[model samples]
Target chain A: MHDRISSLGEKKLISRIISRSRSVFGSSKLMGLGDDAALIDAGDDYLVLTSDLLLETRHFPDPGRPRDMGWKTVTVNMSDLAAMGSRPEGFILSAALPDLELEFFDSIMDGVIEACCHYQAPLMGGDTNEADEIILSGTAIGRAAKDRVLMKSGARPGDLVAVTGPLGVGAAGTELILSGKSTEGFEDAVERSLRPVARIEDGIILAESGLVSSATDITDGLVSELGELMDASGTGMRIYEESLPIGEEVPEIAAILGMDPLELALYYGEDFELVFTAHPAGIEELSTMMDIHVIGEVTGGGSIEMVDKDGATYKLQVRGYEHLSPA
Target chain B: MHDRISSLGEKKLISRIISRSRSVFGSSKLMGLGDDAALIDAGDDYLVLTSDLLLETRHFPDPGRPRDMGWKTVTVNMSDLAAMGSRPEGFILSAALPDLELEFFDSIMDGVIEACCHYQAPLMGGDTNEADEIILSGTAIGRAAKDRVLMKSGARPGDLVAVTGPLGVGAAGTELILSGKSTEGFEDAVERSLRPVARIEDGIILAESGLVSSATDITDGLVSELGELMDASGTGMRIYEESLPIGEEVPEIAAILGMDPLELALYYGEDFELVFTAHPAGIEELSTMMDIHVIGEVTGGGSIEMVDKDGATYKLQVRGYEHLSPA
Candidate 1:
């Protein structure tokens, strides 16, 4: 009689939703649920649509700056479009607020505007409502060339897996904030957590070059993202533990928290880095254009494994940021 | 130093938000923040985008069914697109949920899917997150011919104002719910409040006829909607008090609750009726097609007034469901 959403888990909930909802647009809908962004055929290109929600205390705890919250809300949705190799066009926001100071609301709007300007995404329309707590939702709409759109289900068995930037910065920043530590030298990590930039340019370049076979953004940690790609493409992956591009300060921060740097880089989410599969020749070409680390390679089977320098492999756990699962 | 959002009011807050956000798309954006929906040029047609938020206590109190909540959420956003005379293409939802019963979540999904299927709008993509309370946000995307889309600013002097259907049923339903009265006899009112329908067909018909001068959905009741149209078009209105198409049961419900039916009809939000302006010939033609009532006429001045049968004119107050304002 276990019928609660918590028992079903987030993935199962999503699957149930997809199963119940049928596409009415027919072939005009290029992509639907279970993808990074929904794709709709728009004559010359495919329109990308995605949404993300951020709640108070859950997404950002007390003493969190309002501007940061606003910026992060917009950034999360932008990251979805970035994963699809779509150019940021515009976004609409729906926010619910409790009784609060006008300065707080102003600061949040300022942050959202800053992020929109930074990404060159215009603020199109929005709704404001009253609630018991602060909740922000943003939907980003973008466009990409019909053939150049990146997908999570396009990876081949021999494709090389790579990341656009360093990992664990977001986790490190969260730890710093929760611990109330001064971010003097770890400002980069703090910034990464508060105002992380989506890999829009990198995705566009990779897509246009036609080098990347499949792509996804690492918002829910590295292993979880790889698992999604593997699940969608019906392929497995072998990741090298030492090949992860961990930030220099991550080790020190993890040490202070009495946690392993590698574990932090692996399990901690919200990194917002592009994790993609590319052909070896494409990887060679992309390496010259941008800094990308070859962290893994796609395999034929349906299991994700991590190999250490000692030539031993361990099965990777499928644990990341699931919404309704038991903590 | 009084900087509370409540003091600034919802209108001022929206103005502040619009002032801070700049448009990046330029000419391609046919319409922006202040309209019912944002319009962007998409080659042959214009894409209409709008978003709405629904919170737990603010939008729906306890004893409310989960399916109704989901249905209302989608309906509210669809109303926005309907006001713009846009055909709904698809929608993306972002929901924040607390640890709740599985049946509650399932019921909500059922309601949302029901609405989407009824409207022929597909559920494209969504994000789910954890929160302290249930918060749902939906972004509706639609398409409309560039020249045929109705706008709030298209009203001209001498245009006749009309409403598609009866009003005050939503208010009557809310009153019944708050009083815990039996809904056996007032089932229609209860249904109106809980499962209000968006007038999508009426909007499409009016837009196709090319006769309606301007259009807006009465989500915030009749008075507030007229105020918006007046403000946007720089025109005034003179409404005949007796012309309001009040629901048959609203008067009885209002009398039982010791309230005036006219006041309830004027102020109660969530009616979801289409309030629009048309030429006299257009009104004559439309009256033959649908149940549209001629309630008022557009004037030259920039003030809205209600004229009684005795020829006395009273300035109408712009009070409706405003968020973040004093209760």
Candidate 2:
């Protein structure tokens, strides 16, 4: 029944987005995100190719800041490549703009540009169109060493679980922002939610170690993603609730909202952090380069369970957004 | 003022769209169109990657037919790989659903599954999320013979212009459907518009011939795509209007709608038809295997013109969607 939206006039918006996206990083890019197509070097065997679509209303809050939306699109796709243990070579940014304002697109692309430059990734090629709504789809191509690519099925029982950054901060921070709470002294938490950086460094380091078992990004927060890892590997996990690295600001925000801090940390989504499992010996070396916290261990059971600080354990329900769940 | 529009709930609709896409193509796909990550094969030396985003109000008319939306998302990306003259291997579909419903997404994926089977393409992996409106994005991977690939810049002046199928039907059919005009006895026109087939076979034949000067799909329409070919090669072209192989039903529809037939034929987008320039010597051979049409010839100067029935020639203006134009 929704027929009001039309692709009438959005030229200015598309231009603003395209111009700001000109800034990209990396050396192997023969072309970067402006042409009908982007070409890359697919060395020897294969190239890790991925394209992700980030909608304004679904991926982030509708009234969310444009900078965060732009940053999240690139970061999420980069996280996809990172999970594959690949180094980005280039990306194609296809944007469908709803409005034609320079300010609107410039702010969004500013975040995208910053993220690409930070990750040493370059925009390779993409399409841009004027639609009734804002749509950003990115195709990123990365490379990986032949024998070292990690996968979800690589985790084994007895493997130690670790995370690259503190868990639940992004969801907690977003909850605060959505509720109109002040983020004056909590900029880090807000940034964690808005511009949650992909663990590119950790992905590379983990891939090279040869001992890390498996890995994936925690975009859907800790509970959902951890369960995914366990499902993929055909193993169960026992997590320690007290061991979660909740952001310092989360407690303050939770207290302000009179919400349960643990639930905010557990159920909220869009973390963009990395959850990985490896041998306990690798933690010391990994901690030198990243803020990794040992949160759990793989076990023989068929389900996931979390033990609270009070020495009580409970079954972790599959409560996050499941792609196949009934509406 | 648009802040309220931006803050609407979108991700809530994606679950319905993705659920309709489960295991339709029959594969042991580690993941397909819902998970945070997808695992696929690392085939040979190269992977063909293509992504397309179809907006509900912009790309299609509302109340948006979910079936056509789903089908177009998959076919459009498939068309890109076809433009590259590559064989379909696998695809990952990501979508933003406006709400939770099985009917729309199911019908759409039904079209997608049919196309995949028709082309022998497989479903590999993807992600899904709900959004404020329906936006379908698909990433397709194909394998190409490294050195045998064709590029848009390969076209040279003096080459003969060719197209794979009839044009203007898609635009006309969509107009009929959207305008509430009767599609009775216009079944071909309706199919052409709702589900324009990608020139996959012609692409293969063209690639194998080693004769195509340069190529691209008639996405933005005949005139605009030809402009792209000319822009890339730094050449111009002249076409005889009477030589264009318009579909038989196109004229009838144009007459009923009281619109210019030639204009509709030239400027209609989403044709998904292939247009290429090749050496005159390959004309006879190429005509046998495909529905090849010679509408014009490439000129030394970088301009495009069409000769009317009266033999008066005029410059052809590009009138398709311009990405950077101000809204």
Candidate 3:
């Protein structure tokens, strides 16, 4: 096991897999692999496609929460489309299921249906197979104006970095679930974690506003995702730590778990919010239409650094839940 | 275990999953569930999407042959597109890997890349996660002329049912693998099982010819697939038992295993061949172009029956490998 893929870590393994030459078909791949989502060329628009896998043991914090798993699976895929600033057209799923109670299966599907309904991503049919574990693979297709699509590479020095909502709910809720903590006033955090919303509307609004420079949804921790934006754009981001919108329950949950709320906000991930950079003028205009939190600014430097209210700058840790890596 | 889903069978389970009202999203689904492949309406063409799951234990005859599994995974998805008379646009895959050897993973991806190269379905890169087993979910996107797309419900009475090529190779190859038999002269059968072609060119030509009335790809077996066409079109078929293009190796393999080649040809699925119904005129033209096996004729009767060379009729058994059921 030590010599297995886990030792290589998720990033390395993915890099290795996608590093394979993509020139398979004759036509050029507009955008596939290594991007927020795969984009296929249409006449006047681009087709956004993304896929995510959720395994029972790997993704499900508690085995009894099949419904959350279903919702999260679909939401995760949609989140990728949101990152690319597209509206979902349809959903395709392939599930490897185990022999389980009918209610468990039904509950999972109910959550899947509910999420698909809420997101306007119609559930197209998928394949099902008997397996040792519940393996859900979700693919979502969406469309956006060819010119309006967001990429991770367009951020500039003057662009202001923003997020759609508070973060760390997923990390906090998962902690509470694993710890068997009481679900008292922390229900919001748990709800957000179990049923995170894809920022589809905000993404579309941002892309159409033509004010945004770059964008990506925060599936991985903020720092990790920001790293992607930074690396892709060949730029850096200077964060105002005080401006970090840590979840309401994050403080209490961090205290309860003896962790740092800022750490949860910056690195715990699972916040299905959009982290984007846009012109200040566009932010002022778009802020009236939707909630926007300007947390940082893109910079010319090549490293992501966070500045405290006291003016101390520190390199942010790039850590999140990486698949195929040791926990 | 007795109360597990296996008791429900693959057909029942799939029907139950897809039976959920596709009215989740308001925009009418072009062809989401219960179709050969889900179709999304574009300007002048339909984008076809299909996803299939291949489990390590269930799909791989020899774990050492990760290469074959990778190839089959892509080929199977393309096979669905072929059934719909669509050409490959791109391929997306989500692989759930366990703590695996790098060589094993590399070989699987190599096969995947090679197949994508061969089929002109560019690799659009997908997700990878660590799991308890190697669970591969492959989704293929294809495009076809909206007017020329084939459907299972279009076969009318008097149509001739034809196949792209011979059958039973999948069955024989699998038997050879499972039986650990010497594959001296049966390499072709084994090869077909491992690296089956997705009849894409033939399907496009058939669809464009406007002679095809109905079609489906053989995955569950010829009889089961034919039964699907029969049920969907509300028409029956009179298959000539003598005309079945059973692989030449099937007879020897069957004799070696003390089994009947006809049973293997009829019931053991995974041939990946296209079973389509076309007009007699189209068949004449298509026959001169590509390999076409005239197996039967669509009838107004309600049951699929086989007419032996002896002139006796018998109901073709509709049994194939059903997932989620005791094999």
Q: CAPRI verdict on model 3?
A: medium
- Model 2, range B70-105, lDDT digits (tens) per residue? 667778887877777777765555666644354455
Residue B90 accuracy (lDDT) in model 1: 86
- CA lDDT, candidate 2, residue B169: 84
The candidate with the higher TM-score, 1 or 3, is: 1
Q: Candidate 3: misplaced stretches above 4 Å? A: A1-3, A23-28, B1-4, B23-28
Could you arrange the candidates by TM-score from highest to lowest? 1, 3, 2
Residue pairs whose backbone atoms clash in candidate 1: none
Ranking of models by DockQ: 1, 3, 2
Which one wins on TM-score? 1
lDDT tens per residue, model 2, A237-311: 888988888777778888887887777676675776678888777766777766788998988776889998998
Q: Write the per-residue lDDT of candidate 3 for residues B97-192, one digit (tens) a residue.
A: 888878788889999988888888788866788777788888888999999998887888898999998889888888888898798988888888
- Greater lDDT among 1 and 2 belongs to 1
Provide per-model DockQ scores: 0.63, 0.10, 0.59
Higher-DockQ candidate among 2 and 3? 3
TM-score of chain B of 3: 0.95
